[model samples]
Target: MAPGTFSHPNSSSSSFILVGVPTLEAFPICLGILFCSAYVLALVGNSMVLLVIVLDESLRDPLHCFLAMLAAIDVLMVTSIVPKLLGVFWLNSNQIAHTACSVQMFFVHSTTSEESGVLLAMAFDRFVAICHPLRYRMILNRETIARICLAIVVRALLVMVPLTGMVTNLPYCRSLVVPHSYCEHMAVTSLACADPSPSRLYSVSMSSLIVGTDIAFIAVSYGMILRAVLGKESCRRAFSTCGCHICVLMLYYIPGMVSIYMQQFSRGVSVRAQVLLADLYLIVPPMLNPLIYSMRTRRIRKAMLNVLFPRKAHACHGGQ
Candidate 1:
């Protein structure tokens, strides 16, 4: 059992009941369908991205490798929350073991941080390719990329493990009913009998540090890329290359920022609204990432087509 989450001093175990959306409790069927559809789409789309990236030799490069990492993180992110969410909505199985809830909280936070790190890495790749085309390959070689990925994982673990640990260590003698879809950090912390200010302070500071630093670095990278491409004939191609990344960056950061800040700061925001934002933050990106990449990136699109429609791809190639 997680530290102080036991039901009683003599009780062997305890559980947290996940109340998905309190106001929408009467509409579980609708909410369940929506969540199920989104989960299936996210899984299929991100899985296809991973498959195509692995099978297709043309995408053997740093950009697609980062994309594969993002896909894997998205898969983990959605899987960690959605199954339990489904159980809550469909089977009325909202009761999650204390240890399991803590683990879910860790996975959710860690995967999100990893995704942010990968996005920053992707932005740097774009900057190098555009601003220093000749040095791109040498700068972001396989070894360097591998190290960057290792660093991202290490950083996420270092940051989130402690946050989850702090939450788990709190005395949760209050109501164990988490009022949102998942065991969100704040939602779990709210149930703590101890003052949750330390955990909240840690969470906010770490989140701001990660998001703020990544955004600043990405902005600087794009700033340099823009400066390099201005008035050059390659400007169009430069924007084209970075456009998909920018779209994805917006998809990720915007809702996430709103969700985090609103949850922590805004007294006017209702619980249902907060829950909706949190759901979208996790759901929309995973579902849209492959779709956006497939539509905007010709290589990924072609690779996907070749994988999914091999005969058609062969016929089209033969025609060309």
Candidate 2:
């Protein structure tokens, strides 16, 4: 390989090794078991949410519809990253083909962007419900929600395909061993022989722009909802309604922000800490979102019970 040239255009035949958390290399089995367990839990929990939504006709409304979208994204995000991680941890099968790595990269980023968009849409839904109760259905009907989801998908594809394409096309003439677990854009870009400034800059700018814009919109929505309900008799109830969403938003964004800062800006942060936080930001939320909704939302709780313990649900309903 020359000084400033790539080894190949696409490097489709090349393979990259994923060493799951270099600092935690000694505990591969433990880490593998841990993530495997979490992955199972996430799958089951999110699957149950989907199952209940499908089985219960009442959950077909806009709110549940958004929840369904969120659950699906969670599943996709984890599935894309975790299996490869498990292989690295347990089977010592860390080598990933370039093509497969690119696919995983695409799914990880696209799903994240889609999730952010969905969260913003959910915030808008809450805004309408709380601020314009009488017109909530009129504003967020089935057709409108469908269009919003379509737009989220389209935006993700437009941004992520180019991002992934650019990073994967880089000439990786150096070490192909990715220090982190999955095919994180910057981590893989670091292995390239050429200057990675462009990919790094574009990724950071696009991600910040998308996430920042979503956060700003969510804040404005909540602010309006607060103004609409302040000092009113329904104030407490209104806050309660939005509380679940607030908790979910915090879960999704706070760790994400911490991970990005630790990865890009902070020199004092340890690689182990950086890797752990990065993994958790993607893994923990999907496992917890269904639990949060099930415990907090009465309708979902009822629907879950009805699906999982039908006999008990029937007995309770009969007794009621």
Candidate 3:
């Protein structure tokens, strides 16, 4: 259904399969369940994070501003992919229209790049807050946030659009079955009967540039933060403040880096596992980022508890 897929010639034959994927077996049932669970977790968690951050008056700092933006992006990223994935896996609808598929590919890849930029921004925010606390506000003002968000959107769109052009532009002359649940660039491009080497190379090169630069810059920013924090009077307090960021960074970066490697070289692994891991790379953080990251503040915790049980807790406090 998506633009770059190879569809089954006929649904009638048992031998006919969707692209390079095997027809689902019992194991695939587990995979589908896991996929749905991850999606649900991401949607619910990120939604709650955004809700708590926005609704609570106490949580309105510039840092929380960037975090709210991050949560919003994560919500967008997962919601975009998971609905279609659920339709395919749970409802036996594996068709993604070429137009729809191209759009999906564009958003998914763009969000990936956007997240990278946001992480860099967050890291820089932390660096400034820790190192130059007095000037953090002046340095990263409202105008700066708007500019950074705009730049991230433009940069990601520019980088990923070219790859989308390569994918949708190719003359796909056969079955249009998408091997992956979502319209993965590699999975989509591979379906082209025409040579896809140029597209693949371009994708790899661009990804390397985007992801590599993101990690390098984050490392440098955080490295400075680490040095500054270590030399501080209260190392424990400094570490405590950054604990959430650290968890988020690891949750995002490690799985993502591993996924990049797996995508490139994990040939012997099962496709189901690969798909599951890929899905995890997207979903796990969206879930953990909100739950794990937001718990750092007592105010946020109280706010979350209030939201969860406002009347009862309020009555209890009054009675006490």
Candidate 4:
């Protein structure tokens, strides 16, 4: 590991340089502005959602509790990657220590897996509330919701711990230049001088297992909910209630699935396009989750309005 020569195996002082959207080198200023704006909006939006959930006791149902948890996770997920990405884009500071890279990968993957679990839990909440209306309270009380959240955290840890271990122990003897914005597991592992096949396979399998299980459960829960809503009126109401959750699921999963497919199969896709898609997978959901919930869910929309216009809310309350 000489100073000038970059080629070295088992180098002691290995650091990864994250190359975030190298194709956008010409318009770094514009891209920085755009990404900064999105990051700020994600932070503010998710924070507001969490704030409203905390303040409004009336909105403290199981659904709202789950939404609050989701918002918090979104905040963490974006915070883990976006600030570093902003630094790469804005300040041109892309070098991350191996330890720091491992930390980023852990948080990013763990939060994502936790999000999937939370969505599945939310679907279960909806299913029980809709399909077993008489026993909904018994099924999904505060204690139950807390337990579900605990399980989500535990599951994410169980899956991510080993994956992180595998990636961190790999002998990164080659150039440590990560060809992406942040420290994604694939992006980081791909740089290893040793064979990365086992790490890659394990990563894909774990992701597929966790996310696939969640998706299957969500589908089953929603299918049951649909079957239970017998009448036209009930069907409409059920759809109205679940619309926000559905939209959030789509926003979270679709881009990620596409990115995975492109990574595996679409060799013809340009690196720039893949990098952009990867950013979208991480950036879009957090920015839009709060917006979709606020716009599509009447209760959240009303709660946000009340928070924003407290005096007006009090006036309306007095009139009522």
Candidate 5:
């Protein structure tokens, strides 16, 4: 049990308090400002990405479509928790209702899984474009992209519904203070008086099965892409096109993996470190995804520049 206020055994009426970054006790105001800045940046950046893709018909290629979907997911992912996080840090209002926490957990997990699925889909797009250039248009048309997006959403819900249900259904008679920034599945389950083995097992198994499979597919797709591009004049171009995606993948997964390992296996790791990693896992990717894609992808770069400097872009276009 956590060392905080106790809640009733009935899960419906219970509440949890989020104790965000106790190590920042000395600089709560500074931490709040920093977090707020990151949140605003993520929201604005992702919104710009979505707007650019929607406004520019030329940016409707399958790859850019996937990128837009990813940006939308990042926007939702950060919005799901960051507002409450600010409440905790700045307002000192840490209490969150059990139901609200459950909702947060669901959104966090679902959006995260969807992001992984989208990345894998993007990898497939890259693979098709590079290895099967002639068939790319026929293979990844509008209908196919729509189907892929729908399937990703469905998969995320199917995997997360049961797992989140298991955690929320557990009777939490113990302390209800979650020593983290947001209501995570593991953190919430840890507060239950009942043995959380089922929740734990499901968390690990589902994550391994879903996210692991996505990573494996991405790896194979990139492997084949590499094989196809090797020793060819297009090698540099292909690699450059995929570089931004690979960086986003690393940023998204590495911190999450480390946080999970620490939470489940490494008992000696400090709570502060674990909490910090968890915050990073959620915050860093969304804030950087738009920036990375904009800077690295030529099409997105030009589109963004056009949006920012339409007169100049128009002059350049007329000159061309």
Candidate 6:
């Protein structure tokens, strides 16, 4: 419509309430179905990973410990987005409070940090086991694993808390509309009335220092492990386990790189693409993680069969 002319878009906006999403007229039903599928898949798969690891004592090892941490971090990652997503998609509970948004940001950032750190730690564990098998017992004993995990958690919290706090303290009077499905740092930052230079710089600097460092360490550890593994006759078995983990991590990191690139350089990327990419960051890792884990481990596979098919064996034996 012309500047002085009336338009249906404005007329419709005047009659509507902002309790839910701004609008969902086109393909809303299809989008809702996809969202629910991703959420269910992630929730079920990660839960299975946690249940199997926690229930069986024979599953306790440094490798499983890191995998458990990965599963737990993924649980947090998906939960941070899924509830609000269901609300936005189906329920009319779209008005998130200021504090709620900040808490969500903090957890999102912290859990991402933990994910990267745990990946690095897992790489180190495999490195030590493959490259220094004779010294693996001495280097990654139970106490050392606990200490390393503790340090990862602490470092993740330390890196994330302050950055989130800084962003939360800024004024948000310009707009209440968060463009994405959930409360995200970049989406919220775009709403700031004042120049968000400091916050933006803080976010970038922190990501570089924290995430960059974590990936760098993972790279170095894997390089050494590859060198050692290639020299051994057991290289095939070692790569089978290590390769699956690296593939999962790459599945995650590849999308992560795409997101960071699109966020930084591709202003023309559609909002739907942005949301879809973020979904990959959560749903793919959680769903694929358990599949890869159980496939790679004999103990987990045996336990899975025993737990799920116990009555089959009992029936086969009759009363004998």
**Local distance difference test values of all predictions, in order:** 0.92, 0.89, 0.75, 0.86, 0.88, 0.73
Please write out the lDDT profile of model 4 over residues 1-320, one tens digit for every residue: 32122344456455789998867767778888888888898999999999999998888889899999999999999899888988887888989987889899999989989999989999999999988999988889889999999999999899889888888777766778898888987787787766778878887888888888899999999988888886657898899889989999999888888887687668899888998898888888999999999999888888898999999999999999
Best by TM-score: 1
lDDT of 1 by residue, 25-46 (tens): 9898899999999999999999
What C-alpha lDDT, on a 0 to 100 scale, does residue 177 get in candidate 4?
84
lDDT of 5 by residue, 1-320 (tens): 44223466455345788998857756778888888899999999999999999999999899989999999999999999889988888888889987888899999989989999999999999999999999999999999999999999999999888987787678777678887889988788888878899889888888878778999999999999999999999999999989999999999888888887788888998888888888879888999999999999888889889999999999999999
Clashes of each: 0, 0, 13, 0, 0, 0
Ranking by TM-score: 1, 2, 5, 4, 3, 6
* Higher-scoring candidate on lDDT, 1 or 5: 1
In Å, residue 105's CA in model 5 sits off its true spot by 0.5
Off by over 4 Å in 2: 1-13
Candidate 1 accuracy as lDDT? 0.92
Model 4 CA lDDT for position 106:
95
The candidate maximizing lDDT is 1
lDDT of 2 by residue, 1-320 (tens): 63323344455347888889977899998998999999998999999999999999999878899999999999999999999899898889999988888899999889989999999999999888888889989999878988999999999999897788688667777678888999888788888987888878888888899999999999999999888889999999988888888999999999987887678778898878888999999999999999999998999999998998999999988999
Ranking by lDDT: 1, 2, 5, 4, 3, 6
Cα-based TM-score, every candidate: 0.97, 0.95, 0.87, 0.94, 0.95, 0.87
Q: What is the Cα-based TM-score of model 6? A: 0.87
Which candidate model has the greater TM-score, 5 or 6? 5
Q: What TM-score would candidate 2 get against the native?
A: 0.95
The stretch of ten residues in a row with the least summed lDDT in candidate 3 is 12-21
Model 4 residue runs over 4 Å out of place are: 1-13
Per-residue accuracy of model 6 over 160-275 as CA lDDT, tens digit each: 77777677666555446677676667777776666777877777677667767878888898888777778688888888868777887797777876775575558898766776
Q: What are the per-residue Cα lDDT tens digits for candidate 3 across 206-291?
A: 87888789889888987887787786686777678778877888887787767766766689877766665667788788877877
Give the least accurate 10-residue stretch of model 5, judged by summed lDDT.
Answer: 3-12
